[model samples]
Target: MALIFLYIHVLCLWLCSSTYNAQNVFFQPSFLVTRGPSVTALLYGNSSNIILILQTTSPSNVTGSFDPPSCVPEETRWVLTSELIAKTTVQVKLRLNRSLRLCGNNETDTDCCVNPLCVRETLQVSACEGNNSQASLIVQVKVYARLVSGNMVFDNKTIIQNQVYRPLGECPCDLTFKTCDLWCCCDEDCSTEDFQLFKYHCLPGPFGGQFPDPEYQCSVQSSQNSPDWFPFLCVISPPGNNPYLGLFYQGNKIAPKPGMSFGASVSSPPTLLDAYIEGSPILTLKDQYFTIPRTLNGYCVTSAPVAFLKNFDVKCVTPLQACPTEPPLQTIPEDLRAVVKNGVGGNAVVDVTDQLATELNDFITSSESFGSSAVVCENVPLALDYNFYWKENGISGITLTRTLGTVTLNGNVSLTTRYSAKFLSGDITSKPNSGNPGYQVGRPVIGGILNTSIGNDSLLIERSPMHLWKPVNCGLCSHADVRPVLFGENSTSGCLLPVSQLNLTQCGLLRDTVNSLQDGLVEASLVAINGHPNAVTMADWLNISYVTLNSSGVGDSNSSCSNIPAHLQIYVWTLVTGFVDEIPQKDIKAVEISYSLSSWKLECGGGDPVCIDPAETQRLPVTSSVTFIDIPLNTGPPKNRYQINFTEYDCNRNDICWPELAFPFTRFYTGEPYSQALAKGIILVFFFIVASVLGTPWRQIRQIWSTI
Candidate 1:
């Protein structure tokens, strides 16, 4: 009985060992097979260490028989075999027979492939289902045209679909096979040698495939894990909203709905029926429309049409082919030609004439020809300003102003084009008012010669004498321009007067010129508002109230005692009569001019006893500036008043009653007060308790607590 029991135990152990080894032989969780359009393979297996070697065979040489009624050609026969190896993993590869005639030249031939370009064959492995550890698999092989990377080739024959539809569809950009595409690192056919060259050069995928989740791609070891393997473990995850699932399934396809939309909306150019409406395209002389030139994806496009009544300013830098000389119209840009053609006709209301075209051409060629030999004249258009005058009846006229500038050889030019459409009216040429009623800031101040005669009579006409001066040449002074002064603006202007000689006569003339310049500006009156067309009013006119001229001597005969105006400073006052809607209303009230004269002490040069002609020129710096001060207007009388009364204690008798008495805190207290009473009390109590508590012994504190 003991021997039989021992034999039963041994049988059970043997069966358990066999089951463990069988699980290891059939532990294949996944498999991969490479496929193509013409030649494809359909593989099914669950066991590991199984290799497949596929080879093509002719119809006569094939071992299988073809059924004529089914039209199955023997050239589509393929044999799949396995290699006996010691390794645990198996590798499958295809071996092509180049010498075999697999298909006929045309479709009419007997026992020929239906598709000349595409040939398909199937190899059934009936013996693959040997035991429970091995699964039945079918092998299919085919031959067809292969595509190259970056090049597109279209075949009309019916071929097997080689599309790989993942979350992202098949790489439309990766059209090549067995080669590495530039900036395409995700290509599977690329070897290690190809990847080493373009790994870092991979461009961002169109669907953001280049930037994938790092956790999925990175190989994380068990030792490198943090306190929590996933930091967002507690976070609420979103549902999978995959878009490709709607089109593809597990090895199957689902056609998308025809009504589904994708990408941006397409906008069509406006036609003649939509003329004068909002967003209507600009019209041209022909049936076409005006389009703006643009560049997109390294290609030039002229389809970006412009809209009527839409003002825009665009600037672009482009290369220019330059030379010393060219034809008048050759150098002209296409934009200029479009402007000239569209200057009339269509919506244009102006009367067309032959002279108009002539005038336009003449204006374009008005500049000198680029014919200079000393300087290479690479003239390019700088700016194009288009002003379209429009009314209710469409555009009345169009004016184009083109600015051109020369550039260096092999250089780029920047062109700015501006288009503006303005409404036309009878009063369009009239000047805009400075303000509604009161004088506005930055507006030109009204200034002119004032007549002081009581009766209407002509006075002695005086020379419109030069007053202010500005620098013309190096350190040389010239008469300043008569520019209108603006309100609320402080300005400074000056010049240098160079004197070649410093004799008594020249000194006298210099003194006279300086005095005359200062005197003329001193008497001028400036009005705060614009001039009236009728009678004159002097109520708001500003006159000089104070004048100061600083100098040591005034005798011009003494050459040594020379005094000339060096700097003049003007101060103007304005009255602000309150604000209307937060804007201040101001008017000029008064003007004051002050001058500083610098005297030159002449010394004899080169041991000369008396003053002689100096070889060096002398320069006197003259400067002038204006400053404005605003004073508020007094609208009413004083609001408060005080009357003096006598008291019993006078300031002389009682020191406390003094007008300039010292502050109470300064006289009564000599140092800082106890302002922080709460903080001081807390500090004092804390220190007292610490001293008392620390003085007591531990045994005494225990006894006290027991007594309590």
Candidate 2:
């Protein structure tokens, strides 16, 4: 059992060894520090051993020392087992023993020192073994300083590329070390030359040595291919952190215009004009101050009553001026009144003279009695003047005439006559004459002595005869004829002679001549008559001449005369009297005339024809003793008549004509009396009153009964 145990133990040991050897190994604090400030290192091994070291290309101040001489071994190693696997991670703390300081000169510290020194460092290890081996386990370290001078302290460990670090010691005030001069230091006492060298000379710093100068001159080329210089620079630092900087230069110091910059210079974006970027303000620097140039021009615009530049830079222009207004238009006045003309009594009679004569003539002739009277004659001797007499009858049957003298008449008595007469010549005559018995009486004287004693009174006789006759006379008869006569007598012959006067006695002969003369006189004296009322008045004898001449023929000495007594048996006549006598005469009796009268006719008899009295009946005498009877006529009866004489008549001599006795007829009738008409009206009124009174009460009763 002991021998078997021993062999088993040996096998188990071998297996453990082999398994541990196969496990993976890892390192912590992969970067080793050869600088200030120590870092802890860890080893992750699963049953495997791990070892590490720190290396650097930087030189140490101590010369002739081991490459990574173990002053305090800058790396650590570890091994792990199954029983302790949970605690397999081991920490190798690197407490830097910074008591040792770097000497500026390499001659005094030619041996490797045993103290820690700060330097910029890196940490690395050999390739890891077993399972998945890693060769990139490295760490870099940077160091700050308490004191630094001209010489730079390099790390003993190797560093990787692109690592950044600060120097490990305090910087000297006036030292001019190349790498140290280029390093950035927090201390103000450090020379700025080093910071400036990195700032301006480096690739992308603002003030590197290769950067363009602040005073550098540039030309803005108008090339289509080139991007806009100002806008491109604006995009670079849009907040205007360095607005003065133009494109492709440092410290150009350009600025945007007031009210033009973006964000900073202007709280808002500038108002855009015309194009998106063409009118933007260009930034420039003058005397280290920012300014903007108003360089671009743009389009013009109109704003109604004013024209102004818009979409363009109008830095100092006003925008509210107006154009002039046109003058007020002239107008003409309009006509207002209507046309008018003068009128006759407001009548529009443009010409008045044409109708004056006719109007005057009509006015004069339209009087009530124009040309009415045939003649104007007074009471005069019928022989001295022509008598124009009008019969007292109606207008239809009337005559006119003229007579010659008081004793003998021969004149025209025509239907219309005012006869004109003129005395021409005449012979005188006596009524009778006696002759003598002279010679026979002497012979008988002897025997007659006895008879002479018987008789013989001296006959004393005066025979002076004078004849008077009418020159012209119109016969007062129905025939229209006139005669002019001359009468004479011879005593010895004892014969009466008659002779006709010489005159034209036709109806119109003398009248025509006289009227012609009168018309001529009147016409000739019109102006004088108008001036003087009594100027040469023409006599009305022309009317008489017309009557005589129109009724008689021309008389001559040899013309036969009428066989009538002179101055005692002649009369004037007219034909119209005969014409009237020839008309049929109606003998109207007094009773017939009275009965035919219309005044006695009944006007009303309750709508009936009037009754008439018989022609032969006499009116009854109406006396005080007679009593009137009350007749009860029938309703709607035919008319009746009654006549009674109320006045007395006279049966007188022939010279006194009296009216015949006739009855006075009265039209009378009885109707429904006033009492009856009143009774009927009252009955109608009573019926209406009863209707009004009973109807309302009945309606009320009906309403009351209906409600029950």
Q: Against the correct fold, how does model 2 do in TM-score?
A: 0.16
Least accurate 10 contiguous residues by lDDT in model 1: 353-362
lDDT of each: 0.46, 0.27
RMSD of each: 24.6, 68.5
- Candidate 2 achieves a global lDDT of 0.27
Q: Which pairs of residues collide in candidate 1?
A: 39-142, 148-176, 149-176
Task: Please give the range of 10 consecutive residues that has the lowest summed lDDT in model 2.
Answer: 588-597
What's the number of clashes in each of the models? 3, 54
Q: Name the best candidate (by lDDT).
A: 1
Q: After superposition, which runs of candidate 1 have C-alpha atoms over 4 Å from their true positions?
A: 1-434, 448-484, 502-504, 512-526, 530-553, 557-563, 592-596, 600-615, 643-708
lDDT of 2 by residue, 180-247 (tens): 43333433434453354344333333322233223212223234544556434423322222323342
Best by TM-score: 1
TM-score of each: 0.32, 0.16
Q: Write the residue-wise lDDT of candidate 1 on 187-246 in tens digits.
A: 665556556645687777433225332332223223356335444332332222233333
